[model samples]
Target chain A: MIIQVQDLVKRYGDFVAVDHLSFDVAPGEIFGLLGPNGAGKTTTIRVIMDILAPDEGEVTVLGQPPGRAKGQVGYLPEERGLYRNLKVLDTLVYLAELKGTPRGEARERGTALLERIRLEEWADRKVKDLSQGMQQRLQLVAAVIHDPEVLFLDEPFQGLDPVNVERVKSLIAEWHQAGKTIVLSSHRMNLVEVLCDRVLLINRGRSVLYGPLAQIKQAHAPHSIRVHAADLPLDLPGVIQVQPDDGAFNLTLVEGVDPKGVLRELLDRDVDLRAFEVAPVPLEDIFLAVVQDEDESEEGVNGLA
Target chain B: MDWRKVWVVARHEYLHSVRRPGFIIMTAIVPLFGILVLFVGTFFAGQASRLGDFFVEQFDSTSQRIGVVDRSGYFTPILPEYRERFLLYEGESEAETALLAEEVTTVLVIGEDYLETGRVVAVTKGSGFGSAAVSDSGSVRGFFVDHLLAGQVDPALQRRAANPMSVEPRVVSSRGESQGEGAWGFVFTFVVPYVLSIFLVMTIFISSGYLLQSVAEEKESRVVEIVVSSVRPIELMSGKVIGLGAVGLTQVMVWMLSAVGFSSGAVALLAVVGAASIPARVLILGVVYYLLGYTLYAILMAGVGALGATSQESQQLAGIFSMFAAVPYMISGFLFANPNALLARILSFFPLTAPTMMMLRLPLAEVPWIDVAGSIILLLLSIPVALWAGGKLFRVGLLIYGKRPTLKEIWLILREG
Candidate 1:
């Protein structure tokens, strides 16, 4: 594991920010932490970055605690903080040096990153003078200029225009391709769905779902099949119900019935089926369902535990 | 704690300050203003002294012209004995005409029964110069008349009134140098202390204000978080204090040099006027007091600055500290009268007031060696405590968002840290 957090807890006076949360991110994976605002996502990231210490449990990054591994990691906090008075290149190089990069190399790497982000024109401009999207891009460069082994980004894509969003997404992908461990946190599920391979969904400081994104979606699969046919039957065997809309039918299968078997039966009935798909539930739907479930479960526990 | 990191922070701070138009203007303009004010003050002072010297010289050169209309014949012989010091006119009309035309300065009229009444009245025509000049002329005439009266007293009465015993003053110093007696010590004790205190307090006020405003600006802009992540809070605070303190010191050094240059010119002017020179020890004590005074106020100002959330807030907070600094000023009248009194001694050892009080007393030669040593020790000890508290407050205050912290909140923050 590149980062391991065990039962991490953080309290501000009597308010608990992170409550007994545990998770791990494997090397070379983009792990998404999906949550709403004030859902402890930022607190967890801060704990992992060593910016804040947890009141309970342990956080180990790359086989050591966060501080020991700080230089080997890069963190882009949820708060969009940058030295507005500093020139873009200088700010980037400063952050790189802080991560233990030598000055010469940090400058060289910072320049390269600026070029990659198409922000070389703004190299001499103060960060304050740049547009919000441009500043966000510069922040990304600051995070990655040191070539950190692990990158922790909180809401990295927040406030980005679509073009810049795509640019940032590709950058993350490129970093992951270079075998860097990434922990991505965002409230937007679509971005997380496209970028993340594994996810940890936390609701009110506790993990509601933790696994590979594909597995989580499959586990929460709805009992529905997509059918495309020139003429569709009103009803079929092992099909409990059907809804025809938008040139296709959403067929609900019976309990314990195989969707593949239903598709085969539909094909044998001489139906001109243009397509057959087992309408896998979207990760967003699963996330909402799981979070809702956790809320209900908490209400029960709040009455007792 | 890393020197390299501290240097990095310092370099960044220096660059940031040097690049700002405000800093550049202050760096250049402050010294210029100081020089300008000093020149203006010196010009006015020189003009006033020249006028005074001219009046004294005029009085010494010319004797009073008196027209005595004494019908009693008692003053007939009295005028000739001191005739060289008096110009006698025959009639009041003649004297009045001479006085208006700026010839005779006085006219004395004695009644026919003046010997029995012993009554006299003096009058002079106005030169239209104003009442003050006329009053001054009257005073000068009074001096001459009093001397004349004393000279005319009975010989036996004068003999009896003369001092019965006299002792010749002697000095037995090995150096045989004459000890100067004048208000110079008072100048050293009162004026020097007051001026030095103002400079010290102003330096702290200006520099700490700059530091606090810089911090608050960055915090409000959310830039402090970025800087803090790279450099420790101690490094940031120390760098700012040192950088702006350097600026303050530069202003002070320039002002001091200008003052020294002006004083040297004044000394040359004084030589021409035959006035005593300003002592070298006075200048040395001024410099010593300035340094000591600055150190005491600068550290405390830095602490007060850290608790402020904005430039305006820092300024308001600095006002309170400045009031504390002004305590010595408020009580300086008492200090002057009793330089070595109990209150002065206690204030001299108190770190906050010591720099100003000691500087004030040093010129008087009233500050004991032990008190000076003790004050220095106390001042040095307080510096670290101030820095530590300032650093802690700065660390917490920089990260705080939204509402400004109260003193209680600040205490809580320090405790948390």
Candidate 2:
């Protein structure tokens, strides 16, 4: 593992921002730090980046303490900012130099990054003068300019336009392929679901669920069947609940019922069915279910108090 | 520590700040401002001297219903010019009555033995009173000289009898050498010291103000986090101070060098005002004090900026330190003349007022090297402790938004860190 966080806890006065949280990122894997607003994802990223210190437990980046691996780690904070008064290229070069790259090499890499983003003409232009998409591209260049071994990106796609979002997604994919360990945190669950190898989901400073995305999906997989039936009441003996969805009825299956057996029962009813499909639960459903459960449980506790 | 990074940050700051329009205007004007002020002052002085003459010319009168109390008849043969302006009377009572009755606006009393004693007292009714030395032929003194000594005495003696002698003093040294006693002694002893003291304090305070502003701007704009994550807090703080110090040094050098190189009038003015004796050692010390003082204040300002939620609030908090910088300058009037006064000496040892207080005293008296060195060493030594505590505050507060740390909290943070 390139990064390991064990039982990390951080508190500010009466508020605990991160509570006994533990997670790890293997070398060259894209790990998604998943959470709602104020769920301690940014705080955890900050601790691991060494911008902040964890009050309890251990955090190691690149097999060393957070601060010792300074030059090897990069961070893109949730609230992004650059020197608006500085030229785009100058800002990048300065950031690169601060991360231990020499000025000459930094300039060259900065120029290359600018060209790749088609902002080479804006190299001499001030950051404030750039369009939002252009500035975000430059921000990305600044973050990864030094080729840090591990990159912590918080909401990296927040302000990006659709086309540029695709562009940024490709850049992140390319960087990941180049053997860089990346920790991405964003509200775009589908994107995270598509791109991340593993994820750690937290709520109210405590972990709700964490594991490889495939395994988490498998563990929470619900047995739901989608059927396109003509002239049908859409009720089957094995069905627990039925809801209409996009010209079809999606049925929740009862426990211990075989899908094959349900299909046989549907055929016996002589319903004219055009399509039958068993769909794995999407990540969006899982996120909502987990977060709603947390909210309801907290409300219950609040009522008790 | 990490001098390369320090240099990099310093170089960037210097390059950026020096290019600002405000810095440019200041750099271009500072040296010449002193000379410009001198020219302006000289012009005003000249105008004031001519003010009396101009008014006298404006009030020149042809009609005279005047009373002259000439008991010795010194004006028995008064010149026609004088007669037009005066009506002489032989008795003091008559002259007094005419004066009181408003028959004349003034009365001139010429005493007994007027030929031997050239004293004349003119009393006026509150108009044209201080133009006593306007000794033209139309003047009262010229009238007395022309009337009393027409071809009876030599012209030079008559001229001497009319006006006070003008003297230019020069002090002769024990080596039999003499020099013109200009106000240069006062200049070197008081004015120069005051300038240096204020200079030391202002440079430190103002340059550090710029540091405070830039740091606060970075923090507010959210660039500090990215920068801090890459570089250590100490490194960033050190770099900023070093960078801004270079900006200050560049400006001061430009002002000083331009004064020496371009403005000969400024040097002449200072020389004429008795500032020629200012020792080079004092100036060199000014430079040293600038570096140390700037470091001290810059670190403190950074600490304040870290703890403040915004630049304006940080500057408001930093204002108290600026007041500390001004303390010695504020007390300079009381302590400058008496360099070894107990209060002055006590203030000189204090780290807060030491640099400026030393600047004021170092030139006026024969200060021992130990005191000078001790004061500088003391200021230098205080910097590390300041940086240490300030670094703690910076680390703890840089990422915090919308909250300012209190003094007790800062102290506790210091203790823990």
Candidate 3:
């Protein structure tokens, strides 16, 4: 593990921003921190960035304390900023120098980064003159100009149009492939599912789910099969209830039933089954289910009161 | 403690300020105005003194004629010079005719009881709409005393009888030199102190304002979030303070160097830099006080800037501190009257007021070395505490936005920080 956060807790006055939260990132893995708007994802990121101190517990990043090894960590804050009056290249070079890059090399690297982003023509232009997407691109370049070993991106693709979003996605993917340990926080679950090897989902400062992406998906998989038939017969062996999935019916089985045996029995009974499939549940469905469960539980308690 | 980061931040700030069009224009204009005021003011002052000397020389050599209508027989024998200028008239009409024909400059009419009353009136020009009282006829009185009294009284007593006694003026310097009194003392005593104090105040005010705006801009933009991730808060604040201080110092130096150039040029062409001359001690002290004063205000402004979410908020917050900064200048004039006044002495040692107060009093009075040393020590000692407080505010407030922090909340932040 390149980073370990053990029993980490952070608070904002009376509000618990990150409550006894503990998670780790394996070396060279793309880790996703998933949460809703006011969830503790951002608070956790800030603590890991060393921008905020945790109220309790410890975080060891890159084999040292967060700030002790900050030179090796690149962080893109949720709220973006750049020297608006400065040239794009100068802004990048200056930021790189702050991370301990030499001035001459920083400029050269900044130029190359701008070129890679197709912002070379706009390098000499002031940041305020650039489009918002272009400015964000420049900001990202500034973040990784020194080629840090670890990266933290907080909603890095926010405010970006689809095209710019793809551009930034490719850049992040490229960075991930280059053996840089990366932690990404965003509201876009689909993107996280595609990009992250592991994910930790937290809500109201408490962890709702955390594990390898494949394992989490497996754990959330419903024991059901989709049946497309002309007449779906009820009272089938091992069938408990049926939910709709497009034109097909999702047949839920009793806890320990064998779906293959049921399909074999159905085939023998001369049922007109056109198609039968078992698919892994979508991550989005899992996210909505867990969130809805949490809200309903709270509502139930409120109803009791 | 990271000097390289501080240096980088400072260099960035310096370049940022120096490249502005307003800074360049202001740099060019300060000394031009300073020099023009100095030379032109001295020239007019010099002209007034020369004009006074010219009037005295003309008064001594100019010729004048007088016609006297002495009804009472007081003067039997008249001197030759008096016969030419002070001739007796037969009647009032003749005297009036002689005066109107440009024959005499004045006509003196003796009163009916002139011998007993010693009363006389002289007429010449009209009584214009000015402060020319009829009783103010010094020339007529002088003629009576110098001419008429010379014959009436004994010669030895006559000279002494006209002017009984006069004061003999004397001025002694601290070096025991018998220096005569003149307005020259004002040039060093008042002008130097006034200019140096004002210069320190204006430079710090403008420079610290720039520092405040810069920090607030970074905060509002949320750029500091990324910056603080890499560098410590004090390092960033110190870099900005040191950087902007350099920019202000550069501007003031340009003004001073240009003033020196203008003074040298004036000495060559008009010979009038004397009235505007400032002592070497004042220059050195001005620079020292300016540095001290800027540090105090810069960190304070930096704290305000960090707390502010917008440029206007930062300026308004700094405005509160700036109100106190003006108190010293407003009360410094009193120190001119009594340099040892309790209020003046108290303000001299107070950090907020020390720089300007000392500059105001140092040139005017023989300020004790202990007082000067005390004020400097107090100012220097207050700086670290201010930085510590400002740094605390800066670190805690850098990330906060939209909402303004109350004093209690800020104090809480200080405690927590």
Candidate 4:
């Protein structure tokens, strides 16, 4: 584990922000911490970055405590900030230097990053003059200029246009390919599903789910399937549910039955099947299901479930 | 605290401050206004002096109109010189118009038992009454009074009473260099230090508040977080304080140089405007006191700024420190009258008021070396404490969001550390 957070707990007075959270981010993997707003995502990231101390926990980044390894880690805080009056390149270089890069190398890396972001033309422009999307891109460049062993980004995709979003996603992917550990926090489940190999779902400051993304989805086993046919009767064996609309039928198989077997049975019945696909459960559905499960469990404890 | 990182933050702050048009205007305009006021005042003063000399050279005869309401039979007797300057009138109404129309400069009204009871009255527009314009309506009134008084008094008695006793004073210093003196030296020594001290206090207070406001701007903009993440809070605060102090020092230097140049030019223009010697020790003390004073105030301002969650709050916080900075100037008014008083001594020993009060007393040579040393020691001791407290407050307050901290909360934070 390149970054390890063991039962991390942080509280403000009587309000707990992170409760007994444990996770490990392997080297060279893009890990995501998915949660809704005020779900301890930023707090977790701040803990890992050593910007805030956990009340009772151990956080080791790059084989050292967070404070000792600050320079070895790069962090892009949720609250995006840059010196508005400073030139783009200067701001990038300053951030690079802050991470222990030499001035000459910082400038070189800053210019290269600016070029990569397609903002070289704005090298001398004040950050306040840049469009919001462009400024977000600049902030990303600042974060990654030093190329730390681990990167912690919170809401890095905020304020980004689609094109720039793709640019950043690809950049994160590239960083992962280069064997750098990444822990990304976002409310956008779709983006996380596309980029993250593993995820930790947190709700109300407690982990509701944590595992490989694929395994988690497989375990959730949502009740929706895709079916395509020229004609279909209302009754069908093992077809416990069906909703026909938008020129497609969504079916749910009965207990202990394969969706593919149902499709095969439909074909054998001489039905003209155009397409048969077992619709994969989206991460969003899994997130909602897990969060709702936790809420229900709490309601059960309160005798209101 | 890494000095290099601090230097980076300092360099950035310095460049940003110097680049600001407001900062540039403040740096230049303050000294420029000082020089402009000095020039305008000196010009009017020169004009007034030249007019005085011209009046003294051109005017030879002096007179006044007096209204007398004597109801006694005794005739008045006076010296020829005194009689020549008085013009008695019969009624107050005629005297008022004559005085208004520049016909007479004065009117003397003497009522009942004029000589036996020695009752007499005189009124005049004082000196330089009608010098701007000359009229001949009351020109011979004093000459007629002199002839009438001569007919009433003995000629021998008038000459004896005309002249009276007069005395001249002398002074002796330790160096046995007794120099003739005038009110000019007293005014120069008393007023210049008081004025300069006020100027210094105002300059230091205003410049330090500018520093605080600048820090608040960066904090409000979230730039301080980025800077402090690399450099320690103490380094950042020190850099800002030092940078602004340098800017202030630059302004003071400019003002001093301009003052020197202006004075030399003024001396050449008017030979009678003597060169006032400023003691070497006073000059040295001024610089030392300015640095100490600025540092003391700057650190306090930085501490106040740390608790300020927004620019507006920071501005209001700075106002409180500005009042403290103005205390010394406020007390200097009383110092002028009693430079060596117990109050002045106590205030001069206090680090906050020491700079301005001691500076005020420097020209008078009233501040002892021990008092100066004590003030310097106290100020020096307080600076590090202030800086440390400010750094602590800044470190904790920088990341605190939402509400600005109250006094109790700030005290709690300080005690926690």
DockQ of each: 0.34, 0.62, 0.64, 0.35
Ranking by TM-score: 3, 2, 4, 1
TM-score for the B chain of model 4: 0.73
- The model with the greatest lDDT is 3
For each candidate, the alpha-carbon lDDT, in order, equals 0.69, 0.77, 0.79, 0.71
lDDT (Cα, tens digit) per residue for candidate 3, span A184-274? 9987777667888999988888888899999888777777888888777787888899776688898998876767877997798888989
Taking all chains together, each candidate's TM-score versus the true structure is: 0.75, 0.78, 0.80, 0.78
Candidate 3 local Cα displacement, residue A68, angstroms: 1.1
Write the residue-wise lDDT of candidate 1 on B250-300 in tens digits: 656665565455444544543223223334444565556555556545555
Candidate 1 Cα misplacement greater than 4 A, ranges: A97-102, A230-247, A253-265, A268-270, A277-282, A301-305, B25-197, B250-310, B314-319, B330-366
For model 2, what is the error of residue A177's alpha carbon versus the real structure, in angstroms, after optimal superposition? Answer: 3.1
Candidate 4 residue A153 Cα shift, in angstroms, is 2.5
User: How well is each residue in A1-305 modelled by candidate 1, as lDDT tens digits?
Assistant: 89899999998778888899999899999999998788899888867776566799999989998766657888776766687788998888767766567889988988898889888998999988999888888888787888989888888888889999888888999999999989999888777777889999887788888999988876778878888887887668899888887998888887768788987887788889899998767677887888787778889999897
lDDT of 2 by residue, B103-201 (tens): 886777888866687666666555655324232324565566666776789878877776546433333333554322434334433455456556555
Q: Which ten residues in a row have the lowest lDDT in candidate 2 chain B?
A: B129-138
lDDT of 4 by residue, B1-417 (tens): 666666666666666667778666756764575467556656776563353334444554443344343345233444345455554445677776677776676555556655465544544565645432323323334333444455567766543333222223333233554422333233334444445555566667766876787777777776665455445567778778877887677766665555455445444544434434333455567778888989888887877787787878988977876665566567766766777778778877777677767777776655666888888899899888887777778777777765798888888778874
Clashing residue pairs for model 2: B184-B273, B184-B274
- After TM-score superposition, what is the CA distance of residue A12 in candidate 3 from its true location, in Å? 1.9
